[model samples]
Structures are given as C-alpha cells and as structure tokens.
Target chain A: SQQGEEDPQALSIQEGENATMNCSYKTSINNLQWYRQNSGRGLVHLILIRSNEREKHSGRLRVTLDTSKKSSSLLITASRAADTASYFCAPLTQGGSEKLVFGKGTKLTVNP
Target chain B: DAGVTQSPTHLIKTRGQQVTLRCSPKSGHDTVSWYQQALGQGPQFIFQYYEEEERQRGNFPDRFSGHQFPNYSSELNVNALLLGDSALYLCASSLFRGGRYEQYFGPGTRLTVT
Candidate 1:
C-alpha cells in the first residue's frame, strides 16, 4: 500500500464532457499534486495543492483537497481529445524527504 | 530554459550487470530525484539528492545508489540487476526551498534487462 490510491482505473468520455478523478492517501501530507502522461512519454506536472488549501483552479482543471478524509479530486471541464492521457495523483508526505509518492493513475480517453 | 534531461534514452542490460543513468537538472533547480516506473504502474520514489548530499532514500535496497555533483547533475547506479530491474528510470529536478517543490521530470531512460 503506497501513499496514494486513485480509482476509476479507466474512463472513456466524449469530447466537451467533464472528467473527474479521485485519489485517497494513507497519511497526512504537506501537499498533493496532479500529473499527466501521454502514451510512452514522461509525466508533466499539472497542478499542486497544499494541505492547508481546500481547493484550487488552473485553466480548466479544478482540484479539491479534503484533509480530514485524506482524499483529493481533480476535475477537468470540457475535456478535449487532446486531454486524453493518464493522470496521477502524488501525495507528498509530512515527514518524508519531500519526495512525491504517486498513485497508479486513471487512464482518461476523450473521444473526438 | 531547458527542462530536465536524461541520457541514453534506451538501454539493454543483462542480469547481474550494472547500469548507470545520468540526469541534468532543470535550470535553476538544485535538487534531483529519481524514480522507477514499471509497465502499467505509477512512478516509485527511489531517492533524492540535494546540495551534493543524499537527502532521502526510499525502500529500495543498497544496490540502488546515486551521486550528485556540484552543478546539480545526478547519476543513478544500479548493481546486480535482476530481471525485475527492468523499468523506466525517471529523473526529476526542482528547486529545494525551505521544504518541498513541484518536480519537473525528464523524458526518462528505458532499461530492459535480459
């Protein structure tokens, strides 16, 4: 059992629809981050939300953090075919070396 | 400015052999971290180096070692590789503030062990 766990292993949706991904962690954290990986490519950081922060937004992405529940969510509004990729949630532990522990991730496919 | 960069995009190694993977941190980022990602799995933290010191390590064995230079470049050396050692080695770099940072990752090096 790693620090983070994400559900909905795979999702398929039409273009212009919204996509939501959820992640739950075992312990408290300093911050949580989301990343995107296209096929056969390195991951790209999408956004970060500190523990003290409940919600944050960037572009079409909205992230929410529930510290008491040890869970977080990422929402992509009006997702496009270009947004198709695997998304992961990383929870940075409170006492660790500032390294990020990632979840398995959710595979998102937005059909054109 | 250039993002994080790694060398030898793909490599093949045999069991019990040694492999060295190199990484150059992003501009202005002084900390380097490494991870191993197997097929269909998320990246697992291996270790992190900052200021030419091993700041933190994950649950990996001693066969996995790393070194950081004064210029914020890093090298990951794995010895006595097993078949399970085959994976994508990723290097991420970020500025070490008082606490943590959001990492920027390199394209990664794929290591296949026979």
Candidate 2:
C-alpha cells in the first residue's frame, strides 16, 4: 500500500516550541512529501525528500527520511500559533503507478 | 499563476441522490486527481486523469466516477450516494510528464449527506 501512517495522532505544544511528527510507510518509495492543512482547508505542500536524500529543509521545516526503516520525520522549529494544523505525509511508490498513499495525519496544536 | 480551483464550496444531499463536483487544474498542468477525505482522516485517492483518460485509480468503487475536459478541467460524479459518502472532496493538479509527483490542491468541496 505504501501508505504513510503518522505516529502520535495528536500533539500540543507552546508557542516557539518545536513539534516533531513521525511517519512510517509500508513499502519502498521514490520520495516522501509533507503537507499541512489549516482546519479543513486545502493541503499546502511543505517539502519533498527523495529516496537517496537523508534530509531536506524549507524555512522552519526540517524533514528527514530513513529508507532503511521505511520511516520519515518532520521537525518544525520555533513553531508559531499559525503552525497549528493537520500534517500529512505521502509516500510515492517506486515504479509502476505513481499515485501517493496518505495516512490519517497528525494533528498539531500550537498554543500562543 | 493561479493554483488549482474547485467549484461548489459545499454541497448537501440525501441518500440515494447523485452529486457532481468540479475542479480546474493549475496553469500548465494536464493531470488532475480526485480524493475523498473523511473527517479526521487523510485524503484517499479516488482516481487520476491524464490526457483526458483515467490513468490510475484507487480502491474506490464504480459508484464514484470522474471526467477530464479538453481544457484540463475535471468533474467528479458519484451515483447512489450513501451517508458514508459524505466527505470533503479534494482535487489536485500536477504535471504528469517526467514523473513529477508534486501536486497542488484546491480548497476541497465539502459534501454532507443526510
């Protein structure tokens, strides 16, 4: 299935505190992507980490991929109130069909 | 450039009724994909359209179908709706060439069935 299931379905943190979320997938993937959704709105793409790459960063977001464990983690540094949202990870399977498999996401709450 | 766009922000229907949702892909993108997201869950891929054809599909049933127009717009039609069918229907657009996997999502159309 290659579905990326996130751990700790929910998390609460204070403003300026860092929040980390973990995701584990079922199969090998070409790349893993992270997305954030505010409330029930559309998902905003955060970052994409390729299979060969161990880590990638975008602004306050840091993503690390461990293909050996078929898992990935997203770290948000100095999170603000605006960072409160539902985070999702998508694992894109290698070869064959190129559809993304997503799991139930991790809901993050950043208190001001 | 404008990102992906969807029509009918919210919809209400009764069981056994039919509903159709629409989406317009991002500029210069030729592929569109549809997903169904239940409350508190992630989006589930329904199907994908590329070159005006269904290229790949998920585990959804035939009751859920879609079409892509020549202008890169798409429509999702569901027949014989059920209470379980109520969800946020999301449409995403991406370039299908060169194995690009990044997608731009539209503010989903929230559907509620009674």
Clashing pairs in 1: none
lDDT of 2 by residue, A19-104 (tens): 99999987788889999999989999899899999999999999999999999999999999999999999988762236767888
All DockQ scores = 0.59, 0.62
Q: Which pairs of residues collide in model 2?
A: none
Q: Model 1 - which docking category?
A: medium
What interface RMSD do all candidates show, one decimal each?
A: 2.5, 2.2
Top model by DockQ, which number?
2
Top lDDT: which candidate number?
A: 2
Tell me the spans in candidate 1 whose CA falls farther than 4 Å from its real position.
A95-97, B98-100
Q: What is the lDDT for B87 in model 1?
A: 93
Every candidate's fraction of true contacts kept comes to: 0.59, 0.61
Chain A fold similarity by TM-score, each prediction: 0.93, 0.94
Model 2 segments more than 4 A misplaced: A95-97
